[model samples]
Target: MRKISYNQYQFKVLLYDVPKKIFILLFLFIFTLILLYINLEKSEQIAKKHERLKVSESTLFIDNILDMKKDDIPKNSIFFLDTTRMKSPNKVRDLTLRQACSIESAAVTNENVKVFIVLVSPYKTLDQVKYTPAMEAILSYKNVHVNSMNLLQFSADALYDNFVANGNLLKSRFVKQHTSDFVRMLILIKYGGTYIDTDMIVRKKLKDLPSNFICRDHGFLNAAIIRLQNNLGKKVGKLFIDDLIRNFNGSEWGWNGPLMLTRVLTDLCQTSNVNEMINCNGFHVLNEDICYPINGLEWNQLFNEQHASKVLQSVEHSYFVHFWNKLSQHEKIACNSSAAYAQLARKFCPKTFSLCHEYF
Candidate 1:
């Protein structure tokens, strides 16, 4: 063999080491890839845990099941009024003493239940609307909640389309009362709670009442104090709403109000005899005594001074007294007097009774 130079020998040695160096680099690259994959997996697991924690934080665990607790839940009683429907801010027609009495009575009587007053715009909060002494008293209660809902702001979903169409179509001919009936139904269905008329004065804790129930007034099933559930009540509400839209007859006075509900009840029960309690799909059609202890004809006795004793005695066992404000709205409640309305207001709504002189 010929003698090799030192540079040549070094070149050969370098050539021999090329394969080992490439193997080492390949191993290092593979190891780095493995480490990256392991780190990515750990990060992914942490992200999943964070998402689960967020969900757990937002949802409420009731009876071992997750339930979304919205602002409308926990057995609330709702009242609707159009004080802010068509008026300037702060100059709107404030809730009348009678209305305030009704609200305050509910707030005081139902200490365990939440009372909500749903007003129409341009009122957004309790502060924005004109506050009467009675309203202030009711608002001061811890269980009372005030909300402002606009008819135009209502959702236009399938149920709402019929609702909106029926309301807007009847706007030119019908009064705000017609639209209020529709709103009450929609609210009860969507929120699964109670809807009480502004003329009603609650005399008992409504939380103990059945979840899905309606009352009858003067041989007719009424929606004055409607309490419904989320699941089945939603279906019933949708049915009534659709029926109103399908058979909207604005020409008649109570067509959309009582008559529509009567027709729906008739169809639901397959009988026209709603004079007594009728149970339909766990929904109770309660007797008038539960809400309307005094019928429409007897409604005048509530404000009659001589009938004060009789009215108080009559509503002793009643949960609420429907004053039939439509007819009695013109009647004035006397302060420091022995009238039935006066007596009831003083007992249940002392704030409104104290401020009665200003309104009278």
Candidate 2:
């Protein structure tokens, strides 16, 4: 073979090397394009999911409003307030399993009495709301109606309109609690029906209870469960609202809630005895056994497996069970736990309970 010149050798190396480099660069370019395409696809999917969620939420909001408008508030209406604001569709709403249990229990026990869940969001519109699995399950009940209420608007029309105007709600340390206290009274005044706390699990029909009544807890009368029949012009609810506004204290927690009820009832009934106060001053003061079978101090008994049976037995004659959510919110109730609350939910709110894969 003839010896190749350095120039020829260099030219030969360049010819092969150039093609290899070009091929490698082309491969990298293709890979980068593929990666970019994949990222774009993923981004599109996420964006579409968000958009669909928005549309679904909007439809649900509109449907809730329309449903409320179409369904007239009946004489035997029981109202529950979803006072917590939902941050996003991704964020779990207030309609948790426990809260839904209350709605479900009320709806099931009082089939004739329309159960109205007033979704109250002062800042955000209903279009921004999202329902959890628990809410959906309870909504399936024929007696249950999910509705929207603007806090400001409702307060404006309430007897204690000045309470909202004075910015007392904003000044309260416990805004949600204070707002709920005010809103429930407003609901009773306007609708002239029962206003039950979202934490209560009703085992009996509230429609059968006295037209104007409030349940007792240990020492104080709780606003957890209240009923008022609308009398022409002067409603019993007006009394509660007026008293609530008159004695409204923003600093103390229960000052605007159970304490407020106790104060009002004490003045109206003219006695501290809850039993004697029954049918006193045109309203009944229900015994603790009726709604608060398990007191807040004994709230753990409902969650403790050892006390479940005893707790259940105790509440046999009770109308409903108040789990004292504020005290037990951090306490987990396993789906298969033999606790009283779990058992109650399993029986009364089966659909909501079933949705809990592990714990509620």
Candidate 3:
């Protein structure tokens, strides 16, 4: 090869370094872009995300040591609730104080939601659900009291919507032993907010209970989680009452409330398609889990062993808890269920099961 001059050597070295410099620059630029994309994704979703609140064993430990007392309800917030008795002859597991603690521990997990309990009872038996000191203290939320007018107000509606004065007159009668439940939710319209059942405690703060629509445990919506716009909710309630009364002859639709509400609101989809009706189902949707059978084929209500397993498998996550029906399942796995659930409960609330006594 011909000998190269010094100037050419210097130029060659500079040329050689150029590609290396470009490659380094390119790698750094790409890495920076990836990081930017990640931050952007998180920032965009921050509003919808739960803001990452935690409820762990540490909270439970502190709770056990601290003698937490019920602070006086400073606000005179009117909760138009029908009262419910704590223990019924039908209930299988004794809903003891330990259960309350378990429920309380479950509740504290959610920072976004404040539980609201609506109680409906006979005018005379109001005290049954009202003065349970353990419950009152453990419930770090609001409670509402209402009258069920009659025992049949909640369950007899579908049967009597046509025959009786109200839409669910007869069905309401059957379920109305806890009438405040159905009726007091109307107050959510005028009162403006969410209705959290006493039976349901927070396992976590659900950032989106699918806010655009009310959610059901099943694929469809249920009434247990009623989300109504202030004035709109009141009107829906009034219409339900009036329609029930007008159809005094009774509706054979049976006592399925969430379904009936969906039926009642079917008119809203007049111009829209059937799918549109489904989209708007949230307006009158109920908590499908409570409304439908847990083990059934209802896709939204698919909760149980399978549901929990799937959740554990997924890192991004979906669904939580192995909720048991107080009235439905008994002579079964009440004390002993999932080891994960048992351990989780024990880890978070050691006294919950421990505090359980055969009081009821």
Candidate 4:
């Protein structure tokens, strides 16, 4: 007030600018922090989802679960199908009727062979009314089993029961339907038998099948269709099953253990200390079309060898077709009408042809 000057006016202006500058900088810092927080949350969620989808627990020796020593190698195998799996899922995705028929046809070809049909689910419907006629008319082979397992095991397992009983597991797990296969595979490794699935329809009878050639057509030795013939010790199979039981308690992939089994079987089928009868590097048949199933028409991959040449084809003259033809009621009826399918269809449902015409 005594000496108001130009310098004093300049100082006042500078003071005024400081608060405004501070406010702007503070606002920017807060906005940037908020953006960073959102990005971090989004990144964390993606990481968690990826972890859940694809993680292999097989190689990792889980604590307190059955542990296998390096010496516990070498084993034999068999082929069996657990048909009971078909009913477990709300949507029976991969194990279609056609797939089941193929397996039946394949197993039936060997009259003297012992085939185990593994099924895991509540013994709800025998499906005998639907499949019995088909089985009786076309297949008369013996040594074939209708191995059905109790669905209660999933619930009875103490840990898995709660989720499985509530249908929570059913919603997320597509391979629960194939639970029988896993069990059978373990049985084969432990007990020395074959494990196959119902989705498979055998075109070739494995009578006097070469002990250790990788299978063809159904690409990869689909555990769904296996040939475990080596006379390995009982402990071998137990080791495999233990893996299943442990994995089952830990995560969902036990319901769908492809990569895991692939690693295990490949190793077992390879350098193992099993009896000398065990073929070194046994066959791991990998036919890309193996995934095609019955309903599938055209195959995408070209083979250097056609099935006709390698004794590699399925359902030869002696056995029935696993007609993996997943068709609608209309399609099934139409299929039954064809002259070729007519004989096959009528053989089972004596009146199949008439039924097809009725639909018309």
TM-score of 3: 0.49
lDDT of 3 by residue, 1-360 (tens): 999999999999999999999999999999999999999898757622321121342211111001112232111122223233322322211234434544454445543334333333322222123224444444433221112223233223323322323434334444442243345443453344554433332344444454323444544444444545444555666555454344422234233454555556666544222234545433534343323334223222212344545433431232233333344233222344443334344444444544434311
Q: Best lDDT goes to which candidate? A: 2
- What Cα-based lDDT does every candidate model obtain? 0.69, 0.75, 0.40, 0.40
The residue-level lDDT of candidate 3 at 133 comes to: 44
- On residues 108-145, what C-alpha lDDT tens digit does candidate 1 reach at each position? 88777766676654213322444446556666777765
Q: List the residue pairs that clash in candidate 2.
A: none
Give model 3 RMSD, 1 decimal.
Answer: 19.7
| Residues 1-360 of candidate 4: C-alpha lDDT, one tens digit per residue | 598799999999999999999999999999999999999999877743222121232111111101222122223223444433444433221223333344445444554565544444442322221243333322234444333344445335323344346553344344444455444544454445455555344444454454433233333333444545454333444444455544553244434454445445556666322222134344443333433232234221111123223222432342223333323213433342333333333333332223233421
Per-residue alpha-carbon lDDT of candidate 2 for residues 220-276, written as tens digits (9 for 90 to 100): 778888787757213656766677788778789988887776666777778876556
What TM-score does structure 4 among the candidates reach? Answer: 0.45
lDDT of 1 at 47: 48
In candidate 4, which residue ranges exceed 4 Å CA deviation? 1-104, 114-118, 122-132, 135-147, 151-172, 189-191, 210-221, 233-240, 245-255, 265-333, 336-360
Runs in model 2 deviating more than 4 A are 1-54, 57-59, 62-71, 86-94, 232-234, 273-276
Per-model TM-score, in order, reads 0.74, 0.78, 0.49, 0.45
Worst 10 residues of 2 by lDDT: 62-71
Specify the highest-TM-score model's number: 2
Clashing pairs in 1: none
Worst 10 residues of 4 by lDDT: 58-67
